[model samples]
Target: MKLHYEVDGEEFAAAGQASGNIKKMLKQLGIASDVIRKISIAVYEAEINMVIHADGGTVDVDIQTDKIYIALKDTGPGIPNIDLAMREGYSTASDEVRDLGFGAGMGLPNIQKNSDFLKITSAVGVGTTVEIEVNL
Candidate 1:
């Protein structure tokens, strides 16, 4: 099965909508609770990153018997340094974002921790794409 979601960058209230929906779908599909939890955490982190930094983005999910694949693409200001950005406490979120109780710099780390496979590609002036996979 495949699922797609469009995230609205300006809508903080809707930040987790995609992940939540996916979680529900996984539950209905009888996916194991631990697997669902991992996917949910990883997707939610990526979703929140898009909303907070990328202005907006698209999330595509592909579910198979062996694993689940997720791609998050955004046309926002790309990460300048992937290595730095992946650090547990490195974040470029604006003050306004931090004030909202989000953007503690743990998004990418959490995503990596939850995902079985992860890849991120980005351009300085263009955009970013994050690919994640979790074994079922």
Candidate 2:
């Protein structure tokens, strides 16, 4: 099965909508609780990142018998340095974003921790794409 969602940028209140829906679907499909938990956390973090950083973005999820694949793409300012961004406390979120109690720089790290495989690609002046895979 394949699922797609469009994340609205700067919409903090709506940040987890996609992840919530995914979680519900996973539960209905009888996915393991632990697997559902991991996917929910990873997707929520990615979704929050889109709302907080990117102007907006798209999330695509593909579910198969052996694995689940998730891809998040945004046209916002790309990460200048993937290595730096991967640091636990490194964040470029604006003060306004911080005021909302989000953006602690743990998004990517959490995503990495939850996924079996992860890949991120970005261009300085263009955008970013994050691909995550979780083995079943």
Top-TM-score candidate index: 1
Please, what are the lDDT tens digits per residue for candidate 2 over residues 1-136?
9999998886768889988988898888788889999999998898888788887799999988888898999998899899999999888988888898877889899999998999999998799999999887
lDDT of each: 0.92, 0.89
lDDT of 1 at 36: 92
Candidate 1 stretches with Cα past 4 Å from truth are none
- Global local distance difference test of model 2: 0.89
- Model 2: pairs clashing at backbone N, Cα or C within 3 Å: none
Q: Runs in model 2 with CA error above 4 Å?
A: none
TM-score of 2: 0.95
- Please report how far candidate 2 places residue 99 from its true position, in Å: 2.1
Q: Which ten residues in a row have the lowest lDDT in candidate 1?
A: 94-103
